[model samples]
Target chain A: MSYLQLSLYSETLRLETNVQVILAADPAASPCLLLLHGASDNDTIWARWTSIERYANRYGISVVMPGAHLSAFADMRRGPAYETFLMRELPEFLHRHLGLPTARELNLIAGLSMGGYGALRLGLRHPERFSAIGCFSSGNLLVATGFIPGTSDPYGWISLVMGEDINNPALAGNPDFDLFEILAALHADAPLPRVYMACGRDDFLLNCSRMTAERLAAHPALPFYYEESHGAHDWNFWDRYVKHFLDWYTDTEKTLTETTTD
Target chain B: MANIIFHSLSPALHTQRRLRVILPDSRRNDTNLPWLLLLHGAGADGSRWLRMTRAEYYAEAKGIALVLPDGDNGYYTDMRHGYKYYTYLSEDVEADVLRNFPSLSRDPQRRYVAGFEIGGFGALKYALDFPDHFRAAGSFAGGLDPQSLDPDYCVLTFGSYKQAWQAENDLFNRLRTALTDDTRLPDLYISRREQDYLYTVPDRDFASDNAMTSGHTIKVSRFDFNSADPWSFADRSLAWFLDRICPDRAQLFTPPAAADCPDDCHTDCSDDSLADCPTGKPTKE
Candidate 1:
């Protein structure tokens, strides 16, 4: 597998975002995984996992790890550029520079910690873009309403993104931010991508993961998979968890491969 | 002749959770039709069928209208946290589709449901769980029983075995019962690829032998394709199955063959040669 380190200016954020990208082969190969980094960290954070190479080689997919500062994947007041850069600019750059494929089999978004939140957020908002989504050790910012102080809003992060006051009832609790509710509604309308999420049993975020899992249990369409191991929020757990996600991703890719070109 | 119309719902949200409707097109607004709800597997949204498979074309060609619903990574379930996904897809989404699109036949025979991969499993589970809802059902390389799904994979899907099973065991047990019974399941078409890694030997075996022996009209087709490529698999099998079982959709069945194909399997390769690509080198043009 060949890996490339590239830096691109975020027209959305009006800043530069550095990314560590891995390509299984030249652009002739199928497009695979897109790895987005979590808060306070850059794309290199995923380098510590053994699963990165394993996934790149095993599935023959490329991984794009973007480095973004903390703020839980939010662009902060700097501009909603992080989401814009990821949803729009990143794909354009990859396709222009690396000759990646677009549409089905194009890209899957995944991340750990803050990156996980980003992955879920992106998947929820732009379901058409990604084939699959994996989240690791992150808060369910969508549903973290009461957990955060002085908020009656149902769509926690969504209100934040839309700049709506939490007290606004008309659209405040709108199901946009609550990813789990989005899944429930989406399952009724269409089938969603495979969801893979995990956290250590003792991790502080375990309850959040559990809450997400419990909600997923009701809908037959959403196959939200989860796991709790005896670990914490540190890299050791993420390393193992990421490997598990990669394995499933490879398996899903293999299962999805119904037709192969000559 | 478009039987179904595709609409973008939840546009206000950052993500595009689209809904495809199989209703009477403007030309056929006077006529009644049957509606089949189709769900896509993981890594995909509602557009997987309309955009990639051109299922809308098939729906237009046939009288049956197919609806594709978008489920984000939430796995088509209601969230434990607070999201009501289950209600949204089955109830709210259904209401929205019915209200927005022309009415299809209300007959159960016309009410079909199916999906691929995660969608596939969900389709089967939904049909079995609500046996009276759909007349025919299909799932391609679906993760059928989450609890029975491979532990390694299941753990990743739910984040833990306890949670995965706790949430999905009822469905698993119900499916297990259906596999053992002679009735109570829909006319099922379950399939998988020869090399799929997720729906392993156990899943295939269960779907083929047990799921069938229990009395449901279960037909499992093992294809010679890459299990990892959901789009290709769905485009072919979905078109084929929908045409056959839902003969009301005969027009969607365009013959597709896997031939002279490039090696479109792996994205990463140890071999540097472009010759390895099934599609050959991507043209700069």
Candidate 2:
């Protein structure tokens, strides 16, 4: 459960950035978790707010936490190349620099709030890279208009990211802002990531999680697990559900998908 | 400057150890930039270096990478009754660091080791035992002679005093064996706070061996600075260390020297004793 706070140069951003990397003992053989943080925090928040280390230590999985700032982990129409950094450059850096495993079956992507949206987006967009996806109280970009209370931007800050042409891809290989659009784009028979979504009963983003769950229910071919618990858009709920997600994730094993590593 | 702290399980000790690395932004692009591994004292861990000194400030200006690892109370050795820390450092931690920062130089001449107090002993011992691993070694108030160290430390670390273990761990003995080869030896930089007698003059044998070892650089300096604050002295020790290993780096920041203090008589820092001092404390290094 040892962690390293690294400030490395990001070639994609053309600037130096920081990432908190926590690896289980014998990381070479352990599975990896790309843990993301909420909008209001940086890379250190997860470890600062919860006993993620203790939990990951018990589960024997390595965790990598990166700061996505305010972006929706997308190749922002008006922002930096976060999607390129997170989806491609980051994992490549981990595998090349830290020697952490990079196989699809050996990786899990999870996050909360805006970060939950990030996990769901990246995991869904690149199912070839991860085995399971854990998202808690995800911010539903399924919106057409109006504000999502918890975020700084009213109509999702996502509009700013997607720009005027929401359907137009900002970066090559980037999916459209709408989660339904990304899902519809995915072939049903294509290998899907094992998905887990949980939301607090009192959470503002409960609708986001619910809508996603309902949509997944329609796609019975997708291995999705949904749950609503006595909890909100808070750390207490996330603290508990994150552990629950890890438990569910570890308990169920996914078949190895098509191979891709750099 | 970037502060990178990492933890990894040590197969040698069967436990986890923490290490902090300070890399200068200028050297971030240089794949073969020099590196220095600094060890901490008995009670403190790797973070103490940052807490006690502005190490990153100097590292940034000097264009050299600094590494600090928690040696714990084992004195950076494979303890007779405790963990195999030496093996953990040599076999496990070093390799992990290289992988984490591929920009660091793998050449032994570009690598360095130094320590504070007990860490000073560890630094010299490492340089001695693994001459091909470091280019230079430094010691600040080094416990060079373990027999002269606290009896408790001796028993806890080696199980007895004046025994073969003491002789085996002696820096003088190591200097003889490890420095015999002129071709594969790291230069030495030894310093002490003038009041702290942790390192007196080296014994005759050590002096003779160092004199005969004409192929390498060896320097000794004593600075009158406050040890309680640690950085008051450690900051200077770092500069002097660089002065030997990388002279160009030593020129980056030159602290106020003896000439800066006209009444430089306050070796011990205290209210009444400070009456003899101009700045009301030991001279700032």
Candidate 3:
């Protein structure tokens, strides 16, 4: 695997940001996987903590890991347009410079914790761009309260991105920013990407993952596979399950192709 | 990977400059990590190394920070007609990087410099000019002899061909002086492609001169590749830097153990159970 650390100027964000990419030995014609890191972490976590290089080499896939620091992959009201950067700017840059595949079948998105939320949100929002989405121990989905209460202000950090009025029709209409409203509005004809959701039984975000799973289960037309095992929301669980998710994605692709041909 | 850019007031250039850095993952907290001042060739900026080569992977594995500062097509020199890129790199950029990244080693032994093409020339010049700051230097297909370059470039870079040939600007003359001086000299490593017109003969002469000199150590390696499909000189140069700075850290690039020789596989073949190979071959039973 060939690793490249890039400092790109995002026109959308109007600031320079970092991205770490692991290219397969033969990146030409290789399917690309966008692996996102959680909050407070940068792109290097995948390289440092996990054997992602070995996995990319084995699977013949290109992995693009970009750091979206503290932003929940949302176009923040106070900060950068991270959602636009990831969905629009980043992919364009990758395609132009690295020859990353643009076809939906040749691309995959997966993340852990905050990144997991980003992956599912982005994938669901842009179904035409991704064939599969994997989320592990996801956070920032279906909070009982619109805000985490502690200080006098009920609407704190979450409100900064989702805005003051959580019940706004525009917010409810967009699945990427509002999962709860989007889940309720899911219809039979709406395009749905294949989803792979996993969380450790003991993870602090287990309830969030379960809630996401329950929401998805409500819509029979949406295709998703949810799994929970004995582990926590740590690197160990993520490392093991990330491998499984890749394998499952590969297998699922083959099965879909086989079924389509039949 | 951390991307940082800071403003630097360079007395040499008489202007504020931006220095870009690519830092290794913070998780690798072994110690104050070694650093490489990677200079870009002409027509590129600080970010070129990351875009063109697998430098980040190699740097991450070797646990070194990469300091990439824009050379601004100035040939990384104290240009007479233009900017003082050498001083900017050796002084301004270095100070800025060391100050911002306190985790990076201040020891000269842990600091190195390297570049490609004209940047390669810059690396050697930095080492020779500031021997107290850099422990080692590497040049990959660099323009070693500025005098041999296009007359216009030499004029723009050094004011004239005569100045370009002078000891201050000419690497050959500087290298000769280093050999004669009793001062601590940095280890030099140079690699050139055989087909490269600018560096092939100059690199050979530099290597030959160093070999004849008593105390200085200069290692030279050559490769042959078509211009269309050039070899990754960045990877080779980085490996050379790591080998010189920290030999133990150099082991990261070592080839994996032979497939037949698994962790449990015994080389002695003394025990019967271990003697029989997976291929059903009989051994010492």
Candidate number achieving the greatest lDDT relative to the actual structure: 2
**Which DockQ values do the candidates obtain, in the order shown?**
0.02, 0.02, 0.01
**Candidate 3: segments with Cα more than 4 A from true spot:** A25-28, A144-147, A150-156, A165-176, A185-187, A252-262, B1-285
Candidate 2 lDDT, B157-205, residue by residue in tens: 6767765246547777667655556556778787767675443454523
**Least well predicted 10-residue stretch by lDDT in candidate 3 chain B:** B268-277
Expressed as tens digits, the lDDT of each residue in B87-196 for candidate 1 is: 56777666666676556666677678888777876677678767777788887767655665555445434545567656343455666666786556678776566555
Candidate 1 regions exceeding 4 Å error are A1-153, A156-262, B1-17, B22-30, B80-83, B145-159, B167-172, B197-204, B208-214, B227-229, B248-285
Query: Which candidate wins on DockQ?
Result: 1
Over the stretch A1-262, how does candidate 2's per-residue lDDT look in tens digits?
6889876657775434568888889887899999988764667778877778877887889999987656667776544578999888988888888889988888999999878888888887888888899988884554522343333433225344655433432332234666766776777767789999998999877776787778866776778899898887788887788788988998855322222211
RMSD of each: 21.7, 20.7, 19.5
Chain A TM-score per model, please list them: 0.79, 0.87, 0.85
Once model 1 is optimally superposed onto the true structure by TM-score, how far is the C-alpha of residue A63 displaced, in angstroms? Answer: 30
TM-score, prediction 3: 0.47
lDDT of 1 at B264: 53
- Model 1, A209: alpha-carbon shift in Å? 32
All candidates' TM-scores? 0.47, 0.49, 0.47
Tell how far residue B148 is off in model 2, in angstroms: 4.0
Candidate 2 chain B lowest-lDDT run of ten: B267-276
